[model samples]
Target: MSDTGRRSRILQAAIADGLLHPQRAPLAAFMDWERVTSNVQHLMHAFPSHLTTLHAFAVKANSLVPVLTRLRELGMGAEVASNGELTAALRAGFAPERIVFDSPAKSWQELRRALELGVSLNIDNFQELERVRQILSETPSTSEIGIRLNPQVGTGGIAAMSTAGVHSKFGVPLDDPGMREQLIAAYLENPWLRRAHTHVGSQGCPLPLIARGVNELVRFADEVNLRAGFAQVRTLDIGGGLPVDFETDAPIAAFDEYVAELHEGASRLFSGDYAIVTEFGRSILAKHGFIAAYVEYTKQVGGRDIAITHAGAQIATRTVFMPEAWPLRIEGFTESGEAKPTGTAVVQDVAGPCCFAGDLVARGRELPRLVPGDIVTLLDTGAYYASNPFAYNSLPVPGVYGVSMAAGARPEFSVVREAQLDLELTAVATE
Candidate 1:
């Protein structure tokens, strides 16, 4: 079945199963578990299985423990950026060895704990490296440590998202005056630095551009190993930036093209010379999930139709604030959850429940004419949308359900997280 048809049926089933009631519960999120599994399988096979690779799912994308636990079960490790995410990965049953600790501003306490836990660490700067040296002096650690290098190949389409630029605060710039030699010397002085990492950017980054940046990393690693007269860098954490297709229901992100481009630009990366690590997040989950919210009211304002929904800055923070960069596709559904026909299209503004005038997910979007009690779903939101809820007006975090439906079978909902009730229940569920 077509992905659109399957999602239509899933939404209808969710409403019939009493998952979203206009009166009781007006908003919720649903993840296509089958689609998530398929995406993970695709990632697992994107590279040759004979190669040593760790496809670490970026926990910041969807930090829900249940989802992280499922990824762990699927043999994907966790790439955590903060203490909370690290704890979530641990609670999800990820072994210390499988988790990769990465952060630009990791606290001293966080560093100490990560060293004690023995997870792999990607040191962000020379200052952090000095701190790690101090910590190692007091206590021996099993963590495979590495330094993040900004190849500074150039910026992607989105300047803000680009992290490999010369002045990007993410990693030590290799192109800066005398910086490249200093980095090589750092590695030579500290033999424990065994990995090299680089992430150009995420969305708006072309695959060729990413491969170009990684090619610089390969050259630097080759020189480092040659200078050391051995393979000092055992692993290459080629950070993930495979962009997702938000405008269409693409079966999966362009993993095939991404690998092909990498081979063309950095062939040695796939020559099995060093172990590989990927930290993909959005591409893995974005296309497989969506947010469903009931339209509370509709009004004709300034000769334009307006739809007030429970989704806004509170859920889709980026879309509401930076719609140009993160525009989302909105589809209208009947109160019964059946997709509204496109013939009823009307240019309208989908407004959220927030008080600010700028809190809009879609402005002048030509969607089916919506009415009170109708549903509006934001597609391609599984990664940052539902998991990164914004607390506005004391709005409770919506429940997240993992939905699965077999062919010719009804949909089943697994509670990834329950909606925030009173003090008796919180936004994040404990399971």
Candidate 2:
């Protein structure tokens, strides 16, 4: 079946099962489990046979416990950036050895907990390294330690997503005076620092630029090993930023293209001298998921049609705030979950429920005329949409589900997370 047909069937089944309300303007996120698994397999195939790669799914992209659990089952490790993400990984049954703890501002307690768990650590800055050193003084650890490097690579399409920019706050800048010497001395002084990590950028980052950053990381590692007289850095965590094909029904990320680019630009990385780790967040799950919401009302303003939907800044925070950087495809459907008839295409602005004027998902786009009770499906939303919802207006978090379909078999759906109540803290409130 085509993507549209499968989505229609899943939405119809969700409505029939009472998981989605046809008339209540409810919002829900859905993931194609088969597509997700297929993407993982494709990612695994991109690596060379001689190199050992651990594809750690970045939990910040989609923190749904069931989603993490499923990724773990597919032989993927978890890359957590916060205490909450660490807890989620643990709850999802990811082993400590399979988890990488990385955060720019890891608190004392968070660092302590991570050390106690013996998870891999990618120290962000000198202050963070000091904190880790202090923790190790009190309690010895067996965690794989690494230092994040800002290769000072050129910026990507989005400044905010660029991690290796000259002024980026993510990692220690290698271009700074005495910074390289400091890093080498740190590695020599601490034999436990056996890994090196660098994430060039995310989303809009170019493949060659990302590869260049990885090449710089490899060169740095080689230098450290040469200076230390042994292989002090045995692993390279080339952070993931493989962009998804939002324009097409691509089932997986562009792993083949990305790997080819890396091979061309950073051939040394494939030499098989070091274990490789990837912290891919968006590319792994972005294209496999989407958000479906009801159009509550329609209006005409300044001679242009408008659709007011239950999805806006709450679920599509980046799109609403940065539309150009994160443009999402919108598909219209009738109230009964069938694809809307193709008629005269009208320029409409899809607005969300947020009170601010900037809460629009797509503006000035040519989409079929949307009416009240119609469904609007936001395509390619699996990664950062509902999973990273904005709490503006105290909106409730939408429920998420995983849908799996096999050839000549009935589709199976499992709820990944329940919809949050209007006031989730009501039970704990003592008034």
Top candidate when judged by lDDT against the true structure: 2
lDDT of 2 by residue, 1-431 (tens): 77887888888887877667854328999999999999999998988867899999999999989999999999999999999999999999999989999889999999999999999999999999999999999999889999999999889998899999999999899989999999999999988999999999998899999999999999999999999999889999999888778888878788989999999999889887899999999999999998999999999999988999999999999999999989999988887789876686788999999999999999998888999988899999999888988889998888888998887566688989887756645455534
Worst 10 residues of 1 by lDDT: 422-431
* lDDT tens per residue, model 1, 1-431: 76666767878887887778886668899999888898898888898777999999999999999999999988899999999999999999999989999999998999999999999999999999999999999999999899899999988888888998878999899999999999999999999899999989989889989999889888899999999999999899999889888888886778888998998999989878889999999998999889999999999987989999988899999999889999999888889878888997989999999999999999999998999999999999999998999988777788899998887898899999887653334433443
List per-prediction Cα lDDT, in the order shown. Answer: 0.90, 0.91
Range of the 10 consecutive residues with the lowest summed lDDT in candidate 2? 422-431
Residue-level error in angstroms, candidate 1, position 133: 0.5
Which stretches of model 2 miss by more than 4 angstroms? 23-25, 424-431
Model 1 residue runs over 4 Å out of place are: 422-431
Q: Candidate 2 — which pairs collide? A: none
